[model samples]
Structure formats: C-alpha cells, structure tokens
Target: MNKQDALSIVETHLTKKRFEHTVRVAETAVTLANLYQVSAKKAEIAAIFHDYCKYRSLEEMMRIIETSYLPKDLLLYHHELWHGPVASIKVEEEYGITDEEIKSAIYCHTTGKAHMGKLDLIIFVADYIEPGRSFPGLEEVREMATTDLLKTAWMISRNTINFLMEKKNRIYPDTFHAYNDLTRLLDGGNHFEQNAIGNIETSSGSM
Candidate 1:
C-alpha cells in the first residue's frame, strides 16, 4: 500500500494517543534512516505498522499466535510483546505488505533479534527514542543514536534485559541474542570498524 493509505489504516487501529506516538515513531525512524543512509520510506512504513496490533484483545492476540504458529512459549511472557509478531502478520494479510524488510522490522521491534539488518536497527531504536516516549536514560540513548546506532541498540537491549530481570519476568531468548551479538561486534575493534565502514558502503549503494 502507499504511505497515505497505510497511515490511514494504522490510525484507525490505534487510539488518538497511540496514533500520535506512531507518528512520532515514523518521524524518528525517518531521521535515523537518513542518518544511517537506509531507506526512509521503508523505515517509516515499518514504524507505522509496528504497533498495529497493540490494542488487540488478549484473546484475539492469543488466537492469532496459535493460528499463525508462532512460538507457544510466547504466551507465557507478557502479552505486550505479542503485538510485534501479530502486527507483522496482520499487515501482510490485510494490507498486502509483503516486504521482508518491513515485516522483519515490525516482527522484532519489541524484542530485538540476533544479527538485525540496518532497517531493523533503525526501527528498533526509533521506537525506543521516539519523542512521545519518556523514560530514564532516554536522552542518553537519543544522543548515542545519532553517533552510534549499534551501540544505542546494544544499550537498549541491555537496559531491557536488566529491567525484565529486576521484575523477575521471563526474558526472551532473542533479546539476549541481540545483546550478545552487539556486544561481540562492539568489543572487536577491527571487526567493528570494518562492519561500520561496510554498512555505510552498503547504504550508499542502496541509496
């Protein structure tokens, strides 16, 4: 679907406050995409649909999870995470948005996965540091986002893991995987530098 059509559909699915937040996220995603030299169009689309299923009834989400053959263990965790995976399915089936990059970005925005692409990182970080969100350390993350996307992602992942641990909540394996992958990438100086250069080159080619 076109951007305007997608925005209209998403606004209908969310409340006024949530729709406003969605707009902020899209703007933030566009900025991050520009900074990282990724596709701002794709980033905005992914961010627009990121929370499409957020207000779905628990029963409806549970039904989608089962029918869609998502991990059953997901049910055991907080229901909030269900929206990301469920929205990915809904956007494809309902809006005919079959782009893997957009789908993957929405799918893992809530709980990031291992080896995320540039678009995925942009959406993930955008969602966290979006203007509508206000949380501890948000300013720091916002600053880091402009200078170091991967480092910002790693910081967010670590913060998320620590928050879950403090609450004694069950942690998703993918979150840990994301944390570890970023940790490894950032810890290896030469490898990190090479990958950073390569990402810029790839982004330039795509642009």
Candidate 2:
C-alpha cells in the first residue's frame, strides 16, 4: 500500500499517542531514507507498520508467535521483541502487504539484522530517535542520523542492548547479532572510527 493508505490502516487500530509516534517515525524514517539514498516510500511503509501489533495482548502475541512461521531463533526471544516480526506476518496476511522489502523492514525493525538495507536501517533508527523519544542520548543519535546513519544505528543498538542488560531482561539474540552486524559494516569501512569500536557504556560499567 501507499504511505497515506498505510498510515490510515494503522491509525485505525492504534491509540492517539501511538499513532502520533508512528507518524513521527514515518517523518524521521523519510529523513534518514533521504540521507542514506534509500526509497522514502519504503521507509514510510516500514515506519507506519513497525508497531502495528503493539497494542495486541500478550496472549495474542504468543498465539501469533506459535503459528506465524517465526524462526526457531526468534521464538527463543520474548513476546515483546517477537511481536514485531510476528506482526509483520499478520500485517501481510491481514493488510495485504505483499512486498518483501516492506515486510522485512517491519520484521527487523525491533532487533535489526545483519547487512540491513537502507530502508530497514531508517525504520529501525527512526523508531528509536523519533521526535517524541526523550531517552538519554537520543539527541546524539538524532544528530548522527543526518551524516552517519549506520553508525547511529550501531550506537542505538548498543544502547538498547545495554538497557535490556541493565534491567536483567531477556536480551534478544538478534539484538547482539545486529550490533555485531553493524560493527562489521563499520569495520569494513573507514569513515566512523569511534562508532566502529561499538563502545557503549552501560550502568553495569561495561563498555
């Protein structure tokens, strides 16, 4: 579906605050898409659908996980993280989202992935640093998005991992893989030395 169409579909079910966040994510995703030379339309689609299942009950999330064809690795993760991927499947079947690019963007938006596409990176980072997000260091990432999308994503991934680790939460394996994946990309390049190192200082004193 097109951008407006996708937004309308999501707006119908999401709460007002959630819809606003989705819109902000769409706007931010488009900004990142332009900088990264990705398709803005794809970024918009991904952003709009990124939280399509956020309001679903935990029981419903589990039911989808059980039958949504999620990978064995993804199943090992909790329902919260698994919800995004499973939601992608439900959105596809229920909302007529047939494009694999958009589907993959939605699927990987939560716990990024190895060698992500430009649109996927945009959706992931946009969701993290959208205008309404006031988490510590969000402004840093908001600034990084303009000149260094991949590095920004890497840092965000690191922060996310650290936050979960501090809460003693179940760290999704995809998150660790995503951090290493982006680090690999940076190591393969030469522009961002600081970010390439992946030094995220956590409350636990690990860097």
Q: Highest lDDT among the candidates is held by which one?
A: 1
Where model 1 places Cα greater than 4 Å from the true spot, the runs are 189-207
lDDT tens digits, residue span 26-141, model 1: 99999998888887888888999999999999999999999886788789888988999998888888878877778889999999988788888999999999988888988999
- Per residue, candidate 2 scores C-alpha lDDT tens digits across 127-176 of 99989889778888888888988889899999999999999988877788
Q: List the residue pairs that clash in candidate 1.
A: none
User: At residue 111, what lDDT does model 1 achieve?
Assistant: 95
The lDDT of model 2 is: 0.78
TM-score of 2: 0.85
Instruction: Provide the overall lDDT of each model, using Cα atoms, as 2-decimal numbers.
Output: 0.86, 0.78
